[model samples]
Target: MTVDRRPGGVLELRGVAGGYGGATVVRDLDLTVGSGEALAVLGASGSGKTTVLRMIAGLHPVSAGRILVDGRRVDPLPAQHRGIGLVPQQGALFPHLSVAKNVGFGLVPVDPLARWRSRRERAARVREVLDLVGLADRADDRPSRLSGGQQQRVALARALAPGSGLILLDEPFSALDAALRGRVRAEVSALLAESGATSVLVTHDRA
Candidate 1:
């Protein structure tokens, strides 16, 4: 399956289809997100919105079709090797780790033989993202100590820490209360725009 490359295309899903055994949730989907653009997939609950994101993030296998990032095929690659960031529905932070440490987790080299970044460099990157998320003051606190909105921000910081060109957000604001959801949604929209990342966000909410 070949997709004519679109100029500035950062994320592309061509004829993508996937689902659990014997049940096709996403079928022949085609989508493209340009550089620094944000695409939202909105649907009712159980509508297979997150499945599209997982397929692109390499968390869920694509039964058919191609996933491309920056013009390169990424469906064949491991999740970590795809050079894409994913913010799962839950913040998925480590309760035992400090906010700063959780955000810095991606900065650590996965391969023992790979060159590790300097502690200062990693710390600086963590701090940079924490500031962007307005959580710099909470850096030393654990995820358990923060509010739901705050934890989500930490997750966003962690996802951005690696500076991935494409980010997949799976209902990032769903956990927040009604009062806080809108605020966090706006903040996230602004932050994504400021970061200049190509992002795909899936949610049940129309707002």
Candidate 2:
């Protein structure tokens, strides 16, 4: 279920197979994502695109195959330890926190003692990512006050804040209006490129 490759790409999935239970949704899937590359997995509803993404993000267990990042096997690592940036369709922002806090959530305390940053350092990192996603002005606003596209940008910024090696997008713009969707999609694409992040984006829309 695994194979080694040249030292370049940030992600590689080999012979991956898994599903909700014993039933397999994705079978023997193989893929690679080079550094600063963007890959889209396009499929209709129930095509297991999200399942594949979840497996990559370590949110769902892979019953078979191996997942690698930076040429190292990460199948045994927990989701947080894998250093993945996962952007689900719902945005998943914290309703109780400000936009700035939501984006800074992961940078400081996923493990309090293991990786603690000073308050100023954490704020700087948060601002850097918020600015990268063009949400610097909305940092103080709550998620409730932001538009769908804005919220998605915040979610992405949050993911990018931790400087993860890979970004997994699960139809992040599906909830936006047509114009907003196009705009945000382009922005997200450009942001990833600018950040040199290896990404796998899953969406049903072919556009």
Candidate 3:
């Protein structure tokens, strides 16, 4: 339940079992992701790939076994407290907020006494992540203004904005066209590699 944070990378699931009430989707599954590694969990529609991702993201309770982050157990932690970034199939962006604000949403408040003081710092972080995802110019743009691929990039930037060491991507590129999917996947893969983030990517298409 208690996981120790390592310098980076390393996500392990041991004998993980879980499902919706009596129905089990994932059973006795074990997996590991090294630092800066990209792992693809390829499966059919009902293969429980997303379920495994949710379990690692702490969205689903593990009925048995342990979930470890960098060699530390995290079974008892909440989703946000687990330091896992999950990018669902849907872009899941806020319609009213600009790209920058949405990406910076994960930033922790500076202080209980003076929250306004961290605005500049937060903005800087947002810009850094936006640029990393090649959307710096769209900081002020709304999600409605961006294309599907662009919106996914914004989502990726938002997930990375928090500096989480591990990321769980569940068919994040499923909405993109074939051409655009290749481009966006390459960009995201490169960015994650450069940032030294260990990621588990779930996809139905083997390609």
Candidate 4:
């Protein structure tokens, strides 16, 4: 795999704090993840790992501090505009759409060139991403027909399709079987490194 020479877009959280109203989960958190690096946030149940991702993804408002992507403040922008790729713990794939459509959903608007604006282009891009996740042949299948691990890969493919500078994964490998988990993890790690993706993973898994 060839690595991108340019910066992967740095992710920095300074003095960050936020949660549901009248509640505080992450407090005064300060972190810096350089281009192409993965930062894992690990904690037990109710320990606020998900909350941190939610806040960063703009799903949950930030009550304090700042989130920066490549030195630009991102809290004011919506999730899609912030150039973020997110894989929630639930592997939130659109049940109605085929795996190919789901993975290609983000690319249509994200790419501006007229040549890339075609549906065929999006489908090709979808195939490329699925191949990376080891689901190239499952493109026509629906999410319901896939195994848990396969579904997770579909969700992951959706996230990766946009080629977002920042990737936020919430227990991304949770649904995978043990043998598949290790292989998937290594593949994902290599993919991110090759593509120069800056990633943050939130997990409660102690192992």
Q: Which candidate has the highest lDDT of all?
A: 2
| Per-residue lDDT of candidate 3, residues 60-101 (tens digit) | 889989999988899888886777787889889999999998
lDDT of 1 at 45: 85
What's the TM-score of each model vs. the native?
Answer: 0.91, 0.91, 0.90, 0.87
Candidate 4 residue lDDT tens string, 129-194: 888777888899999999777787788778777767788999988877788888767766776776
- Looking at model 3, the pairs that clash are 1-76
Better of 3 and 4 by TM-score: 3
Top-TM-score candidate index: 2
- Candidate 2 regions with alpha-carbon error over 4 angstroms: 1-9, 111-116
* Candidates 1 and 3 compared by TM-score, better number: 1
Tell me the spans in candidate 3 whose CA falls farther than 4 Å from its real position.
1-7, 110-117
lDDT of 1 by residue, 68-146 (tens): 8888999999888776778888889999999999999988876554332689878888888888888889999999999
Off by over 4 Å in 1: 1-9, 111-116
Candidate 4 residue 58 C-alpha distance from true site, Å: 0.9
Model 2 residue 78 lDDT score: 91
Q: After superposition, how far is residue 176 of candidate 1 from its true place, in Å?
A: 1.0
Instruction: Score candidate 2 by TM-score against the native.
Output: 0.91
lDDT of 1: 0.84
- Per-residue lDDT for 1-207 in model 2, tens only? 111112224799999999975888999998888887899999999999999999888889999999999889998889988888898898999999999999989876667664436888788878888877788999999999998988998998888877776889999988888988899888889888777778899999999
